[model samples]
Target: MSDEKSKLLQMVRDGKISVEEGAELLDAMDEPGTKPSGAEKELKDRFLRVHVDSAEAKVNVNIPLSLLKVASRLGNMIAGLIPGEARREMAGRGLDLSKIDFEELMNLINQGLEDGKLVDVDIEDPVKGRIRVEIYVE
Candidate 1:
């Protein structure tokens, strides 16, 4: 174990910190100049990654939560840019973008990351073949 990890474990044993806090602290400690394991790196990332793979095509996207926050703010600022008719049209089609709670969604994602939850989705379309999508904090 790394010295930092060992120290954290020791702290746990000494009752200086709870096991859960020690685990969180140990997870936050990554040695400089050392490559982190995939899961380890993902735990520390501020972006959410969506990776899709299939026989026909592959797509990898990394979306920063910070960018989403900025976009949400910008969208609020430009809400009036969309014509009333267009907004009503979109709402009629059941596509109401204004109803999305971006902040709440981000908060849920952040909580999931903190809880070390992994979500994997797989789809098989007759025409598209097989596709695997992995959404995780990274």
Candidate 2:
């Protein structure tokens, strides 16, 4: 491999640069004179995509939601211990359990796929709707 390519690969392996970032660099290297491909350009906004594969009655949420809930509870406790606007901000934000539609999740997944990043998802029972979903940085 070329020196630059090797460097990028090493960074990805070392967790310094993400797979999406490495893909963009590779695209740029492949097209030395011209601009990056549309996929490469969009990688800047890339995010991991999660989807629920079950029907409306059996929506499965990502496992991370439980962890997020725990983290939020811990954050609330910490905010109580601290003082000032940080606590207020945490209170205002609440649990931040807002849900995103499947379309948005699909868009993020497609973007990640286009940019050559690993996309992961899970299916689980729903809390209120047919399905639950989550996404993250890859």
Candidate 3:
């Protein structure tokens, strides 16, 4: 439990505030734009992450979506860092990094995230490896 929430509950337990008022206070704490702490910090905006692990290999990638806007400037430098086999594996799963238009994709992701998570993909490929990809709005 968050410190604020715990304090609110304590207020109620100590008879310092009515249950209804405590409820209201708790509700207000959740208002958007409020600074988060503890576990809530984990829910903050973060780089898109891709994770892969297997007995034979492991991979971890963190990409800031904003960087994609400047990817053209970086040319193939970013892609070059990834192994060809991994790139091929991603392509086989219908995710062709080379073909993606980052700007357009970011727009679409933004639209999808207005409601909730935009994409959460988990795949276990017998030939390639295990993979988890998560994309979300901050």
Best by lDDT: 3
TM-score on alpha carbons, each prediction: 0.38, 0.25, 0.39
Off by over 4 Å in 1: 1-44, 71-100, 109-118
lDDT of 2 at 15: 56
List the candidate 3 regions with Cα displacement exceeding 4 Å: 1-44, 54-57, 71-84, 114-138
Which window of 10 residues has the lowest lDDT sum in candidate 1? 70-79
Residue 27 lDDT in candidate 3: 63
Q: Model 2 segments beyond 4 Å from truth?
A: 34-138
lDDT of 2 at 125: 27
Ranking by TM-score: 3, 1, 2
Scanning candidate 2 in windows of ten residues, the lowest lDDT window is 60-69
Q: List the residue pairs that clash in candidate 2.
A: 56-130, 59-131, 60-124
lDDT of 2 by residue, 5-122 (tens): 5655774686544487557656655664433246434433433323333343222222121122122222222223222332233335452222324335445544543433232323
lDDT of each: 0.48, 0.37, 0.49
| Backbone clashes, each candidate | 0, 3, 1
List model 1 lDDT by residue over 7-37, tens digit each.
4466468654457655654544443433344
